[model samples]
Target: MEQRPGKREERKVTESGHRRTAVAESGSPATGARIAGLGAYRPQTVVSNEQAAADAGVAPEWIAQRVGIHERRRATGSETVVGMAVEAAREALDAAGKDANDVDVVILATCSLPTAMPNGAARVAAGLGCRAAAGFDLNAACAGFNHALAVADGLVRSAVARNVLVVGAERMTDWVSAHDRDTGPIFADGAAAALVVPAIRPGIFPVAWGGDGERADLIRIRADTGRMEMAGREVFAWAVTALTPVIRAACERAGFEPGELKGFVPHQANLRIVKALGAAVGAAGSVTATDVTHTGNTCGASVPLALHALRQRGELTAGDPVLLLGFGAGLSYAAQVVLSP
Candidate 1:
């Protein structure tokens, strides 16, 4: 994805109408996100793929083979996305040697909020004692985190906020149909939060985006009505066709190539989509890193969950260029190329 002077990168069909390449070093400047702070919270209950399948009348092997999910975490009766997000946000702030009071802005990225009033951001601010801070919600469904990053980037560009906290949390288990097999093994409950602040010039930078709303039904969860509507085959095909361009556009805008990326953090939607995306973008080997197989899909928390897990494995370092991509409901897609702090 070579840059065309002033143009930013985007994901869609390639210039040549075929999948392109995006390669980067793990600690390079092309893609990176400093773990300045991070945290997460899960319900006391744990649900394995087999358990979900059994309860939903689906074969465990079918779920595993199709989605590459082994298990997912579920919240207890008293837990809420707000609580999990607050806990994770506090942990991230603690890791950064700062408290929520130090946070200037809050971006609560979630698909399922505890309530409809006050927005999730306001509640999170109250919990963290950051009452003076301004916060709000920015949703992109499964790509909520990526969308939040774009929003934060714009805010930083305007110097409106210095220390921003982005939390992707969800209690998806509450929405799943206990008798529906399509969603039982896929959706999970979890939260992952991060603190994004100023870094060296090579830090978090330009991101990219892509989408085709006409196919919004590829993956959807109705509100207080029909259960999840997921076209597995449709989603897999769309991912392969749509994701390549998003990465290419983002990398080119950052003045890099698909082969220059060190690591790729795509939304943990399904193992099948992840693998298909990797293959389509020519990253079938080690260039693509993942955690979806074990964690299942945590809705809005998917990317951050992978980040949290990756950092724990000692897989990240300063100056790394990490490419984050996500696609979900709305038939939307977003990819950001941020430099690690």
Candidate 2:
């Protein structure tokens, strides 16, 4: 018998005089990584501005003028965060022509879980039937998806994972007070996912991420009340001004000018901030996503949900250069460029 080159083999004779052999296996690292597919799931129950405003003691027009959200999804009793993630992931895997066995890792990005114990990622993996896939949760508030995406890119390029499933799922209603006008109308529930795979040419570019701990108090979950609190005016100001530079840096790192972008998908924080940031970055020619108008702000799930909406509308074409930005509580922010899938 002959041994193959570049491979090591060990041979030993057993006490019974039988021959035994062992060989070490290795995987070749990928040159880059790309999003192979995308999917999203929004709850069936719709909360109209009129309904939301009645609880907050405001008029429907006020909700529309303030957040530009006429309606948003509210998860039902059966729509758990992990359950929504599984549905989104299944659609993504199908779109990528993959199955549960194809997933090497599952990253669930969220900040609004019912409880801290038994992370949602593991449950999501189990629901998807990805029995052997590595699973974990990542929290960067609304920026969670972008942060998870960066991690997935590294895993694929480093040969740590052949296919990485990144899902952003949130049940914001669980953390927000329906009677609190400031947080109620602006937050919603939904989930979205992206499947990343090894690629010969990079599709997911470098991420430009940073956090402002100094402004962490701007948005938070009040320890005493166990509800979300936000300085709407302050967050809006910071997003329009501070996030412009981050978006530019991401495009620069990807070797693309703002004018070259085909689409811009910022966190569906609010319609005002999304439009302001898109214009400030000079992505005039790009189709800007206004998913917030219908989906409101889903926190961690916003970015991927917005992207999926664009794809469904036929506003994004395959291989088109799209810039994604996510920012929220923790005063955290992240931006990146990815070719449309």
Candidate 3:
């Protein structure tokens, strides 16, 4: 796979004067309970279809024809990363009829942060007024939310936290190059949070995950690492080969077959990836929800954001068995056989 994506590599001057490489591989959890409440917050500044095309050095026709994205949310100069996370968290808590005081733990997942010092999670906690609680981060690229679920699952799984707040938030647009045609229409900014608790009965099932660092160079951003490198063709082939088996294996492990699923919510990275995964698993008629078609890829926030959109559109229903799948940088991927509210 060829590398493409540009990133303003965060640099620093250490006391010893030795430069450091800060690479992260991390963080998700689950409850059998329904979402309780779902909320998300995208930047209010909408980059119009014409505007994004002009900035990315591609025509509006190219963006819409190739990726199906007419517009995407771009963070304002004043919108801090943690600020958006807090806003999204507040929305989710409000919808659930819950408050910051009710939150037990906070997990913030992102590949890009507002600043290197605070890690975003802490500031989010401060904003939400979660006192005396620990806040940390997870960075498994796009698979972050699902991985965060695993961590939150352990919280309730081990009886450590009762109502854990797991957030997948990222400002990917900050990392995108205006001229990179492959990524300009593919990356967006947003955040999504889920309040997790231990599931009831055969509630939250197991998640099947794997990573191939060998392909870590596939989709990345950094110095000397061009903007958004992708073997779009290769990733398409890989998704068909890897995601299908992973989803099916997870289904079997959870004592169900792929055909029985009510919804298949894969990260809305691209239509090519989702449609390929669906065909591989024989999920021809199951509802396949996507917002990346319009929001582009919000990186770590992809899954939860997609689910929120599903619910908003009334596509999600009670007793629905939804399979959540994610694949991204770190060459990481995750799939969960989840039972709905």
Candidate 3 C-alpha lDDT tens digits along 128-240: 99764568888898999888877776676554555678888888878877677777767889898877654444445678999989988777776675356666666666777
Backbone clash numbers for all candidates listed: 28, 0, 20
Q: What is the TM-score of each candidate against the true structure?
A: 0.85, 0.92, 0.85
The best candidate in terms of TM-score: 2
> Per lDDT, what order, best first?
2, 3, 1
lDDT per residue (tens digit) for residues 126-240 in model 2: 9998756778999999999999999999998876677899999999999999999999988999999999987778899999999999999999998998999999999999999
1 or 2: which has the higher lDDT? 2
Give the winner by TM-score: 2 or 3: 2
Model 1 root-mean-square deviation: 11.0
Ranking of candidates on TM-score, top first: 2, 3, 1
Q: What lDDT score goes with residue 43 in model 3?
A: 83
| Poorest lDDT segment (10 consecutive residues) of candidate 1 | 19-28
By TM-score, how accurate is candidate 2? 0.92
- Residue ranges of candidate 2 with Cα displaced over 4 Å: 1-27
Index of the highest-lDDT prediction = 2
